[model samples]
Target chain A: MAVSEESQQKRRDERVREIGFVHQVLRRPEFGAAAGCVLVLLFFALFAGDSGLFSARGTVNFLEVSAQLGILAVAVCLLMIGGEFDLSLGSMIAFAGVIIAIPSTVLGWPIWTCVLLAFAAAVIVGYVNGWLVVKTGLPSFIVTLATLFVLRGITLGLTRLITGRTQIPGIKELTEGDWLAPLFAGQFGGSVLVWLADQGLIDKRPDGLPTVQGIPVSILWWLGLTAVATWILLQTRFGNWIFTVGGDANAARNVGVPVAKVKIRLFIMSACAATLFAAIQVLSVGSADTSRGLQKEFEAIIAVVIGGTLLTGGYGSAIGAMFGALIFGVVQMGIFFTGIDTDWFKAFMGAMLLAAVLFNNYVRKKASEAR
Target chain B: MAPLIELRDVSKHFGTVIALNGVSFAVRAGEVHCLLGDNGAGKSTLIKILSGVHAPTTGEIRLQDRPVQFASPRDALDHGIATVYQDLATVPLMSVARNFFAGREPVVGWGPFKRMDWPLIERVTREEMAHMGIDVRDPGQPVGTLSGGERQCLAIARAVYFGAKVLILDEPTSALGVHQAAVVLRLIVQARARGLGVIFITHNVHHAFPVADTITLLNRGRSLGTFAKDEIRRERVVEMMAGGRDLVDLEAELAALRRNGATLQ
Candidate 1:
């Protein structure tokens, strides 16, 4: 009884010296990115609030932009947490767009079939990327970079050879009244917009149409994907596998985790995300261009990094990347609404990235020092 | 009786640097087999072979007298051989419960809705830590915050809990304190009582002697011999180990260095 009592006292002392509540909250990877989101929002609300940046029309514009990037960022965030990079994401977008367009606009196939084909192509590309990296034992960055260039070249060469032009147009007409078109390319909640306009809560154009017809489906996709990703990372056994594979793969393997399969599945997820991005773009824009989705891969990666995912991997959060995407969309459109030269946007991204890294480092150090 | 797991005349040569040469041993159910050796006495190589990290260049591994070969670590684990390594034990960044069930997590629901049973996981982790006499404040706490001894205990407990038959621990108590080492020794006894064939690899005879049913000595990639604890006195096993001469040589060299130094003068 005396020994147990003494040990109990020691445990109590150890608990007191352990991490406090504040330190635990601060140590979470999302804390810095969520804070950054708040600060950016505050800046925009003060500067661009009067310039219609918060208006229904302007809000939809930026949210649509965020939603698109959020989809890819969510996938990239998972891959990064699994300790890999897919540089071919941007090229896959362009290539999948061409794949969707060539069938629907040229061969006159059904829009649904074209969508399926694009998904199929993405699966093959993803599997090969995963296979090469796993089999060759090369860094994923190098293997996917090779894929990036090859996919871009193939997209360009194939489009010009068959269509005699770099662009495929008139896809909008073909998607009209198609049952499957609305899932990837349309607005939701039109009745909600109508009701809001009727209640005088939202603006309506002179023609009696709401300035923003409805919320874009992409935002729905973004939130759904984020929720799902968060669920996978937190609630599922596969989520645990991903963390283990990224944290210490040799240890994970020793404990019987299938390291190769986890990595391959994550790579496949990234490719599918790019394909979804392409489908949304192709159906909405009414055309597929070789230049579509250029540099989107880097943008998604920046959003993920700003979200506080370590480049080295094994630790991060999906919600943080969501806030990271939100911050990005707000700032990009905020500069436009505030009438700053748009060229300065890229410079701001660089500064924000550096600031986020410094802040994350500071918070991590402080959290550790507190204990 | 046939052994639960047995290695017969195993030889492993790595580019002419022979790590193990014609070594043989057997671990039976309900026994604690202590492997005593120096740092480079083929103990690691032998463990590696048994754990399926490396296949023997020439040998036969028989499980219940049935010859078997493991192609990978997973293959070894599938055959109910769980190995807890010295360095790569538990993932520090992971939660204690998650680390406890890294590959084999208990799930609830069906198909896509299947997920980790959070309440059960936490409860099991806390209960298991308590069983091993380690007070875990929270099952959700990252393993990194634990002291070195606690982390070692967590790894050993994980191995003991999940190990179906054979439990191979490589220097499990190397980083432990006196109290923690005692806790691990007691846990080993419990595992053996539950019909586990434990291969406890350590250079410390003091740690090995109390619980070991059989003691095997190795030196320079060769097995000196295996003896029942009755046939081997605690001090005699130390003399037969590779470290006996090496420690004496190290002390003599240190004394000569002291003689050459100005402080000695």
Candidate 2:
């Protein structure tokens, strides 16, 4: 009887405490980002409802912009989660664009070959940045900061030397009718927008063109890359290595995790993502300029920080970063749709960054308190 | 049979400071070798040398009677020597299963498509923790949430499960309470029972006396001697650890003060 009673008591003590659904959601690492995203959307919906902010056209516009920032933000998220930063991302974008344009125009190389060359160059730059950071044991912030200037200088000097100007033009004419154009810069669902315009379901420009034309291919790239990154972070060995190396580099080294190799690979991946963004931007605008990607590196990092990643590293997710970029996209475009002055945009972004970081810190504290 | 690991006359020096001087130690299979010392006895330096964090400045290290040199910690791990440093064994933010298989994760798929074997990692982590007498509620929980003793147990269980021939634990029980320290000591005994050559570094004689088969004493960067449990009594061990003369004099002074029945300001 004593033994039976003890067993029953043990079972009772060992029973898992049932958690409520609200608590469950709050416990997720991305909960702050998701909540912030919803709040931002609701704010725009209520304030800018009459400015066609909810229209398909406005939605696509925000999404297109979000897609661009999202691409860079997602990669930055991966790097941040792995316990590093790449401040050279924005400059790398300009550098990659220049690489694509100058080669195709000045050298008369085929468009696709230029794409390959740009990608290779981006990866090499990223690798060198990572190698210097890990080998010298310097903080990535300082290393990438130095790289940022170096790259910007190179892009400016090279562009001026080659074209006798800051921007490279006539790329669209040179790469006209190229097969790879559609893959990078083509639009989708244009017929749907046109039909809606004919049916009086959406606004039409003075020239009879629908405000909603089609989805940019960059949106597709954003979605696809987010999915791939989420998979790599959550389901693969390299993903685990990323978390390990970022979480505690010394412990990871002791366990033989090859810390330098992981950091280097992440750097290369970040650079490749930058190249993709540059390629899309170059093809869409049909030009590459020295100042094309100015301040984009800060925007990408801001998006990641808003996504609930720790500034100190070791904890984050890609889906969270996606939602963070979504929040950013909505706010950036939503401000324009409102009657607010465009000059207030930077101030609003700074506020959002501060609020998101405070919210993330609060959520982390609440979740850890349960233990 | 040959000892599992042998450190012959190993000395480690840091510039002008000699941290470990002419120290030799060994651990046999199925035994717990407790390395005992005071604050500056160079126990850490000795363990670092053994774990390959630092190379011995002068002596040869023999694993099963063959001379070997470890260039890094990874080399030591490759030789089946796993070290679990105090408070540094696991990453606090990572999940239990992830911590269990941090460096050597199991993969199920082919190249590029190759992925972590999640089910296997979770199941094995759960089983190994249970085997170490810990009932982890969920393998997905972060290691930081575990109790300090539970974390140490997890580290010991991990080393055992990973086929380590020599388990080097650095001050595993130093920060633990009485109950937790008992739990860790029990795990050490369990490891010894499973035929692991355990090197348990601790300054507590009472904790060591319960489970150690051989005790290696160190003082001021030098080894006093290595003695089997039956070869020396507990009092002698404690006195020797406190440098004998000083400890005896201190004890006598305390006794005299107590006999006077006076409290001093």
Candidate 3:
């Protein structure tokens, strides 16, 4: 009995030590990006010191721009974590935008019908990308790079053949009639803040004054997508299969995982996401040029890598990618407010990319070594 | 009383290279049948056939005295055959519970709206691990953090949980330390107690002598012989693996060389 009691005490002591160890590891000085984000925010606040930049109106505009990029970044992050890349995403957006616009503007189809057709096309393109990659056993970089060029060329050729110009017009007619236009781009009370206020679902406050509590409809879309991605990544048997396949295909196959199927599904998901973002852009702007959405794939990839996703495969978070997009949005608008040259924006982006990669490498190394 | 699994004159060839030549073996319920072989002894080929990785060039595999053909590992699993490979087929970054429940996770809700039952998975995983005497603090912890022996044990427990009647362990102890090896051997005995037919493959004869009821030695794509542990001693088994009386000739040649060297020195 005495021996058992002593052993019990020892177990208790070990548990306490383990808790302490976990706490220390969790609280270590490795949150460099988080610190960097705070530092950037401080830099903007202290140096800019402009009332216009700090106003609620500025914040709303910032969120509006970030939402679109955030959606794209999250999708790219999922694909990157699954151990693949899609350089054709930007071209896909342009393709989808033109498809939706042409049908609604030129063919005079209902706005909803055009949107659905565009979504279906996105899904099909994504499926084809996945199928080709799996069937040929080629690297996704090569497959998607080839696809990017093919899609861009097709978009250009189709636009010139139909509209006899580089850019297609008459999209304004569709937006003027459709109710979805205001939801995407029209502002309430002619200000970004009032537009945000009109999006609220509930209005309740202690004071009689009107409470500004509405969330942007785009944010609702992001929230919905985030929930779905989280469910697919964490809560399904297929999710397990995806992680295993990405971690090591041979090992996953030996254990009876359907590796090809998972990759295909991920590809389809990415294309569909890009298409959805394109549809939003079309509805908001009410028009699109042949070169619309150029280089968005690089921006999406940068956001994903910055969010701490591994380029090789098997480790990442979709939510992190959303925050990475927000960082991009803040830097872009923040630079503009500081009266910095727009051309220097690319240099700042390059520096941010380098720093994020270095930070991710260090974090990943530390995580592997821990415990 | 019927054998849980049996291979009848199985012959497999990889292109022109013959891997297994008309080898037959039986594993009875609650028995440890050790398959011993040197390098390139066609042990891996036999394992591949049993685990449904490859079909035999000529032969019939019988489970419960009925002929069976497995199209995939999932098919083999359906027939209660589970193989724990040397690398312990699992995702290192995923949680222990996730690895255990891969390809067959429990779900709640209807189609297209279904979600994994995480709480149930955690509860069942903990219960299963406890039943196997594996003390783990969190089922959420990644399997990569576990020791090699613990990983093997987790695989064994997973097979048993999935209702495997035949557990084929391929070189499970080759990469383990002495203490870790002992732990695995104890788990083998535990599996036997649970009425599993275990095909424990190893190159070491000493490790087999403790838990194996029958030992089969293979050399050069052919079985040397199968021996009941009670009938043949460890030395005899070692001798057969060393190729009958040829070991004695080699030992005498070494002794003669030593004697000549002593005189020269």
Candidate 4:
């Protein structure tokens, strides 16, 4: 007992004093993602400063883009951690958008009713995707791939059938004074930004508007949801279940974890995230098109992967995905600021994703297996 | 006292193949009952039924003399029965503490604002591992870094910590070296001392003879018989395991073959 007590004391001391900054950072699965975020920011800031990429206005511009993708990326990160995928997520955004827009604009439904209806449709699609994957024992990739095409095809066909044009219009007029509209797409900090510009603290746009006019509410949504996701992943029993199911489904089942339920919930969450993104898009743009969320599923998955989430599942963080979306937003918008030909964008993105995945694998090996 | 877990005349069939037939096994508290068998000798089938992986086709299982039906593995676990399979049932990439308190992790605070009790988890994991005679310096370390024997120890300790009345270990020592197998046997003795009814399953006679209080021999899906340590000698048990083909007869055959080969030379 005396020897054991001494060893226990030694362990306690080590726990308290041995967490070096380098070790602490290396221990985190998202450390590489955090470093990559910094590298991307530095690259854009250095190469594109002349176009005001480092300015407050420029920051908010990229933040808006990141927020939209960040919402989807965060949900994708959770699903990936739960050992599943939803390739239908991107099409879900378009489907939800069209579902909301067609009813609110053409069928004369209230915006609130339309939003709820769209969410309900998303829930059903999400449930079906999860149920089919679980019951059929098929890979979620193939299952959601079918959903992707089916949802997209239906969105395109239905939009054309109803409105003659692929795009639905007159949303701004229908939602002119709706209370829920501003919460979803409203801008804030406008007066404060205008005051700063008037005092010459920031630049004015060529249209005579202040550069940092206001911050998009979606940024708030992004930060808020990221916090919630982090909490769910780290603090809850459900979070532990996610890690277990992803790590090994059979072992999880043996230990009494409801593997099917956790996976189904994750799928539902991914679809709901797609719908949330659609809501923001439709409300902000005042219109919806069949191709509104084109390629968004792949983009969200790329962002999640770049954020240090394992494609095989069981290890990742929502914060990493948040940082990944920021990197994507900065680079995509920073190219415009740099006056570079946008044709090289896809190649550049592909290279960045490859580098991030390689770096994450290296970090995972070091943290998991190495002494 | 009644056995902690008892299976009476249990038989399981998958279509036409009878995996286990009329096998009755009992493990009393504070006793180590070793189940011995060769490969495909219905050992896997028996343990699966005991751990609720599969229901017995025709039999009754009793817990402390009361009949019990386990609908799922969770139901078995809830009734104080736990199983540690050959694979150790661990997530390699997860931390020791996380793997320890995985499915039923303790949480603090209220709904939508709750968090894992990390302090409690780390403390309990380290303490429990130490109690099991393994000093885990850091519970935060990934379980994959531990040796195979250490992983088995961790799994056994986890079962004990979860209030298991009966611990069923399937081939826990099959993959270990000499020293590691000793470590697992030591853990089994420790568990028995702690009053847990341990079902130690292995094919090695040497492994079973030392730590087992009761021995159950299985062959071709039927139990040869269950024997107490005093009732059976090591040589006799080995003969029983070899299907009554005594080693003396085998050696005589080998000698006759050698003489013929020598004459031919």
Candidate 5:
């Protein structure tokens, strides 16, 4: 009789005690990433406190690195949320760099034209990557992995064939007065920074210059892209399509969402982001190398995963990826400032990634499990 | 009055295989037309054609006595023919409001300021679920949290709200328990009362009998003819559904086996 009483069925529709506001906040996809970001900052502050890591100059140094990676992260975040991967993103950066450098330096083309050409090439490559995945029904991983090798090979082979050297130089002088170079390579907010330094708000160098000259345009791009990507994810009709497509492509198709189109556009978005990365690097550094952007795709994906995007897709946040990339840049530089073995940086990041994923898993179960 | 939707001697073929053959079916507004079939009975094929996932190899589909062709599922939806598939009704990870308005999201403002009307969406989602007698305390909750019956009701509510003239449900109750099945059957009746023609597909006679105004049996790849609810009784429907007296023969065979076993014992 006791067993029967325990097993008795109740009406399934009883509106259970409502979950509290705090519980609801805990359900956000960005909760883990945001927490991890603050924890990373706290940890570094303790370890590297005396190394000037908190100084404006040093802060901007790490932020510049984060900004560059964040550019790729925004695009990768969207594509991942739409349920595909473009592993060639890293290779495309190197390829786009050469496309920008070779044309402007060797062929005497304008820097702006080379940048445009690089973007155009990226669109075609992205189209191919998406087409193969959509039409052949191959997993995007395998398709884009194949693309990775092809792009890198082309970058190396074409650079060697054309210039007889792996590196391209002499593009810096051409960028000095170039109309488009400042958009990608230069900095802004100099007057504001100088004013701050005059007011003793930030440190000034021995030569009467501010320790940090200005904010990099790359930082602006990163913030702008994150805001736009977040808007797309949260508000637009296409945003809803992306979520449903990733959540269940078959179900999305049944409900009349254009799953293929969403995926293909996402691929193109990531490719253009790669070109943007290359434009910034190749212009600012004043050289191009065949080996640039190696393992960057993995880095971006890791940042996205740390930011709380599902590895399997369908759920994530751009703000989360921003913090994920910030954590990456801070930790990489934090080891240098703290006098830890530089080689331990990768190991530490790997550990951080594992921890982030585990935390995300725990939070996911908490958010979705039965009351 | 002409039926809201009619399949006139429609047949479908996939290369050499015949999936449906000359299956004539009609569903009028204000009725639940139950499609009863056993396994491999071409029920899936017939509904696929009716919902515009596939075109008939022969014959025609008429809406209110006018012929129409649907090139895709979206086309069918545009023409007010909505289908709620058994497993393909919703994306589980998305919020109930998001899933309710998955492909057709309503927006406000203009240009870059245009965005999903979350307040409006949440209100509509809550109101619609309530209309279907489902209690959804939070429209922002992931749809996966809803019980199977509630999810089915959400799908039905979505189709009904989207102006579905003829609703196609593909084996909506086959995976549900008795209680859940009854709930879904109640939704079918509600849809009928709203003057929308409901195509209720199932193999279970018990589930079909209560809501069905017209019973249409499918066997192999053809229809056994349609019958009004008063034209047939429960026992006769069951016998006909069991491949025409095969159940009687099966019962006799079981009895013979029992007698032989007793003798041996």
Candidate 6:
């Protein structure tokens, strides 16, 4: 009995240690935005009183805003961890949006066909970005910057030539289609009871109006992508190679890793992700503004950096990037409740970015010192 | 037995500069062949050629008495030739197990469904490290956290586990302290005991004189001579590496400096 009790106590101690270690890692100084996100949530709950601020409807609206940004942030996190930058992502999103819309609305192609073509086009652009960067041995920043300008120019010229305007109408017919519409735009319920009510399987609601209890379908997509990215980053050999290449290309090559191939793949993935998100937005909003995705690259980069991913490369997390996006959402909604001037939001964003960067550097320095 | 690896009349040039000229060396199994040289003595150039980082402009490389041309490092690796550079060939952020099994990671399943078999990798990495007498607390810890001597030992162990018949160590002990250097020297002997042909490269005679079965001196991109362990003394090897004629000249120059100082006084 004594021996068994001692063993049980030891096992409990080990479990506690493991949990503590995980918590310490998560709260690491580099993950400033993660902590900031929690603080922001509490701040809103306390300050943004019940009615127009802290209500369930307001929370849903906040989540809806963050869902799209969260997807891009996760993609950018992967690229950053791989030790490269993509300045073309924002423009790529616009490019993809236009690709999907133009074919469906103007060319009269089926919505599914347009979606497939848009995905393919994004992958090709990514391939080109990767190939050019690898073959030329140029910095990815320069290569992606060049691509950004070229794609932007192409987007502008194509949209103007095809539609005679900078904006294009979303495929209304496809949005109304029975088979294709629900996947792109759907909602989730927070509970089983609410879910049943939302689905109209249970006629519990008095007014018969949909309760819309679950989360947005976009949030689910974002969560699923984050889970996949995390698994790839942590579990796969390719993920290991990604960290190695980003940390030091020459060193990675010396060890016989295909550095060039990894870099190229990373570029392609960033472009493909941007394009996919753009397609989702088009189906949801029913319109594509040529300028819609203009500043999204900066937003994505900010979220990635704020998430504790190194700008220089080799270390970061997708989950952290998601948290970064959540913080952005809360701030955007919270500012309105605080009666702050909407124009001041950009300045606030700039301040938050600077703070997050400083915090990340400090944490990295500490971790290295610990080593 | 025939030498496991041999380079005959190997020569390499880069535009206007000749990095190696008529460089020749051989390593038999179960022996430590030391390559001694000062800076700019074509040591690096020769290693690069043997390791398939570059092809010699004019020369023949033989493995088990058969000529072979390697297009890339992977080709060299395929032939059981591993080079452990002075930096130790490790990724700092990766776990020790990951770095140990880098390019040759074990996989499960088939096709796109294949994934790294972590349990196998971890168990094997732990066993290998333990056999090497490395007391690592966790195989999951980043290799960067280990000491310099430990890292060098891990590199040697990794090469041996990967079935390297010929291990080329480029200045393995140059960056280590006296105690750490001694640890690496012991590992070299352990490798030789395991029937590996280790080509230990270094500028320090003391480090090489103890374990080396043969010593070859390189001076100014040319081979001074190759001597069997019984035929060469440590001082002579050092003298040859310092450039015999150049050393005499340097001594004379120092004497002149002393005389001139005396006259001024």
TM-score per candidate, in order?
Answer: 0.91, 0.92, 0.87, 0.93, 0.94, 0.91
What stretches of model 4 exceed 4 Å from their correct place? A1-19, A205-209, B242-265
Cα lDDT, all candidates: 0.88, 0.88, 0.79, 0.89, 0.90, 0.82
Better of 1 and 5 by lDDT: 5
Q: Identify the leading candidate in terms of lDDT.
A: 5
Model 1, C-alpha of A343: deviation from truth (Å): 2.3
Give per-residue lDDT, candidate 1, residue A263.
90
Put down candidate 6 lDDT per residue, B6-45, tens digits, no spaces. 9999999999899999989899999999999999999999
Q: iRMS of each prediction in angstroms?
A: 2.7, 2.1, 2.4, 2.3, 2.1, 3.0
TM-score-better candidate, 1 vs 4: 4
True contacts kept of 6: 0.31
Candidate 4: clashing pairs of residues: none
List runs of model 6 lying over 4 Å from the truth: A1-33, A49-53, A188-214, A369-371, B109-113, B259-265
Candidate 2, residues A234-329, lDDT tens digits: the string is 889888989899988988887889999999999998999899998898988889988978899889888888888877677887888888889888
- Give me the runs in candidate 5 sitting further than 4 Å from their true place: A1-19, A366-371, B244-265
Docking class of 3: acceptable
* Candidate 6 lDDT score at position A238: 83
TM-score of 3: 0.87
DockQ of 6: 0.42
Candidate that beats the other on TM-score, 2 or 4, i.e. the better one: 4
Clashes of each: 0, 0, 1, 0, 0, 3
Question: All models, DockQ values?
Answer: 0.53, 0.57, 0.44, 0.56, 0.54, 0.42
By summed lDDT, the worst window of 10 consecutive residues in model 2 chain A runs over A12-21
- The reply for model 1, stretches above 4 Å from the true place, is A1-27, A359-371, B14-17, B64-66, B175-186, B193-195, B204-211, B229-265
**What is chain B's TM-score across the candidates, in the order shown?**
0.88, 0.94, 0.93, 0.95, 0.96, 0.94
Could you tell me how far off, in angstroms, the CA of residue A53 lies in candidate 1 after the best superposition?
0.9
Q: Candidates ranked by DockQ, best first?
A: 2, 4, 5, 1, 3, 6
lDDT of 5 by residue, B114-187 (tens): 99999999999999999999868778888878878888999999998899999999999989988988899999
Residue lDDT tens for model 1, A80-99:
88888999999999999999
